[model samples]
Target: MTPIRIRIGRGGRGRLSARILVSQLAILALTGVIGFALFAFAQRSALDRTYEERAVAIAKTTAADPQIRRAMQDGGGAVVQAVAERIRQSSGASYVVVIDLHGVRHSHPMPQLVGSPVAEPIVARDGQPHVGTDQGATGRSANGRVPLYGPTGELVGEVSVGIPERDVLGELWHELLTFAVYAAIATALGAAAAFLLARRLKRTTFGLELEEIAGLLQDREAMLHGIREGVLAFAPDGRISVVNDEARRLIGLGTALGSTLDEVLPDGRLRRALDGTLTGTDISVLTDEHCLVVNRMPVTLHGRALGAVVTVRDRTELVGLLRELDSVRGLTDALRAQQHEFTNRMHTLAGLLDIGAYDDAYDLAVESAGAGQALTEFVRGRIGNPLMVGLVVAKTTVAAERGVWVELADDSALGADPPQLRLLLTIVGNLLDNAIDAAGDGPPPADGRTVRLALTEDERGTTVRVADTGPGIPPGARESIFEDGWSTRPDRGTARRGLGLALVHRLVSRHGGTITVSEGPGAVFTVRLPAPAVRPKNRFAEALPVGGDRR
Candidate 1:
């Protein structure tokens, strides 16, 4: 099937380049016409002036001749006429009329006009050469008059020479033709230059018309600002080039264009994720206040590196919901384990009653009830906060289901609920979960797989410690384990792993606290959180410098 292509703003209209070229050509043509008119007028005036100067020189020379002067002083007869005619022919002038002080013509081109009175008064009567335009029998011409001086140096008559206007017109026409050719050449070159300039402009604009470029700009603005995700673009020199509203809101940035990443964001996992130093897809970073999923991709055009773009998505609420879901899943697993255990005990009791061993069945039921009661009472007594107590109990049940033993240390104690309970829970919950996973990863130890947690609170602050009995973390990977997306185990699926320790570290740092890890046959993670009243004024700022130092 043949397909038809549709073009917008391009039908029944010239392309931008063609339009520009045509407009430039039109301007050049009009300019050339106007320029030629001005050139012709100026050339005519210049030619008039040049012919006048030539006429004056010719008249002065003719008047100075001994023969014409003598003839004019001898009362001017046939001798004067002959001499004037001879000088006129030699000087290439239209006519040379010798006139006396009475303005009577002694010589004329027509013999009949000889010895006739002139129409105008003699202009050179004062013995000064005079030049001007004259309308004579031969039509208009450039005329110059000079007083004739006799041998005694007295003015006798005047020699008037006229150069025909036709000569000036002929030269003007010749020069005009040459100018026209040059003008045409200049116009052609200008048109060619305009065409090349238009092509260059077209290439720079990607052949898009002005209207299309405006439309694209509008569309880009709408899309960039309307999307839910935050968008940030950088130049090749690592300066921020483009940032949208959502980006500013999500990252808490304000008028941050043209700044480098370091100038805007503090040195931490978030900055590293955005700057491509910590490269990954959908990398999760927990800031002091937000949980962000960042993705960075380098941009290139025509094999030229055009810096990079990083997209940020606010995942704070999503992560919170996911955490709740994980908590629910843990509770559900605990319930299933308890149900299975209850079923086995019920079966044992049923079998015992049928075999007439009621005493054994009674003992088994009491032992199961007592063990569960003792663990709960132990956790409730040590943890003063209900949420922390619940978390510990649930994690213990889940750990038991996975064949790992969870033990609360005997010295663990919290007098009352802390001001930052949520942060404390995040810190303790993640550590316990990680410890359980580590403890349950391999074969049970001789003493059985055990994960121990210790909590302490005083006037200073709160402290949490979790230790696992499994293959310990290597010394080289101790610090890396706290990095986002750096997991010791293989990835399970799309579910993001390895954020637990990272989140814990971030919270601890934000609260002006410290977290450390030690290896005592296994990985032991410890965290110390400062009291709210004693927390630093700019905890995040202080923590950034620490992170920068570490990096």
Candidate 2:
């Protein structure tokens, strides 16, 4: 990465980064100010101590001087005053006062004040030395007062030495200049570090402003969940990077972020599609609930592979509706063919009548019309629901087209929620289609090629049993026969070849119904679906056809 420049001000490129830099610099400045104050305070104290030490040394040396001691014993004020003046001038002390044992000043800077009491308070009044800061003849100073004694060690007089407050402050200021220099260096270093940090942030942010980042976040969230399709993203290491709500619902996974794709998708095929080998094109993925057509795209930036994203379009409901349409279309074609055959028969019958063959025409008309009439009459009489009756009639035509014979074994009525009836249509319609395909092509109404559906209703529920003269489900596949994408016949090239049974199983389980399969000579599947709770106005239960066996 190349070095990036950043200006830290109100008009900077990144307001957020600039603000952070300003904050850091402010903190550093405050810290330096505090440190400088403390250093100055300590320097003042140290300078004061140096001044005090100088004062004490001068006082003690003056008191121990033989010449000054003898002069004090001899009461030679001139000699003592000369010695005090010499020490004060040489050591740059504020003042040097020599007081006799009677608390009278012997030597003072002012010659007229000799033989007078010391201007300052006596600190060695108990015949010992004392050191402290106080106001004296010369304004406030660090003073050291020493007791003077003769050769016999008898206290005679005292010598007081002091250094002025101005001298201490002057030295403190000199040391403070050094501290100020150090503080400036420290503040400069801190500002440099802050500037570098801000520059790094600018590069990482792609030089976008704070407002731009917020807008990007909002747009990403809207695109993730606003669309109907499921979206899943995976990092390069195979962990799930992002999963939208639709994806969770479609795959029935919760809180799948940061998990492996395999953990979210138990189906092996679906997991493999999310692998990094994705070539940025769409593929189909079959989960337990959805037949999702997935489009995978490799997520890259600047030609670097980051991960992959997958978009899932749910096709389960659309596929079911298409299957239903195929059944209805087959029924229409069958009805059209039947209509043509009847029309031809009518033309033949009309010719017969014209030729005076009256017996042949009458027989032909009854037989042709009666065939369709009997089938509808039988279906309507057995099933009290007009909707179920129509479905059965259509299913019969479709079964015939496939060369399989379909018949109802028992007359049953339905009393269920309207939504429940729609689900039952799916169940019955899919089962009939599968049975037709399984029975294969054969002459209708023949042995080893028939499909029988029995509908029975009682107080508890409706039971539908479908038995077909086809090969039975094997023992090994009985458990997984209802699972998605589990098809026995792979030759049928359909996108949702085995999804019909899976849909049946899903609807049945949702309604707390059960479906079982048994092997007789062929396959027999029985489904028991319960009726919805009855109300006072309920009218469909226990219904018998008025045209046949109604009371």
Name the lDDT value of residue 196 in candidate 1. 96
Q: Write the per-residue lDDT of candidate 2 for residues 325-408, one digit (tens) a residue.
A: 555566688888778877899899999999998999899888987997899998877776778787778777766766778878
lDDT for position 501 in model 2: 74
**What lDDT would each prediction earn against the true structure?**
0.81, 0.73
TM-score on alpha carbons, each prediction: 0.72, 0.65
After superposition, which runs of candidate 1 have C-alpha atoms over 4 Å from their true positions? Answer: 1-20, 59-88, 95-136, 142-162, 191-221, 230-244, 247-316, 342-373, 380-382, 409-419, 456-463, 490-494, 509-514, 518-521, 528-551
RMSD of model 1 against the true structure? 6.7
What is candidate 2's local distance difference test score?
Answer: 0.73
The alpha-carbon lDDT assigned to residue 260 of candidate 2 equals 85
Report the alpha-carbon TM-score of model 1 versus the true structure.
0.72
Predictions: Cα RMSD each: 6.7, 8.4
After superposition, candidate 2 runs with Cα above 4 Å error: 1-34, 42-104, 107-200, 218-296, 303-328, 380-386, 410-422, 438-449, 457-461, 467-499, 516-524, 530-551
Identify the leading candidate in terms of TM-score: 1
Per-residue lDDT over 61-179 for candidate 1, one digit per residue giving the tens place of the 0 to 100 score: 88877887877777777888888789889888999888888888888899998878888887777878888999998889998888888878888878888999999999999999999
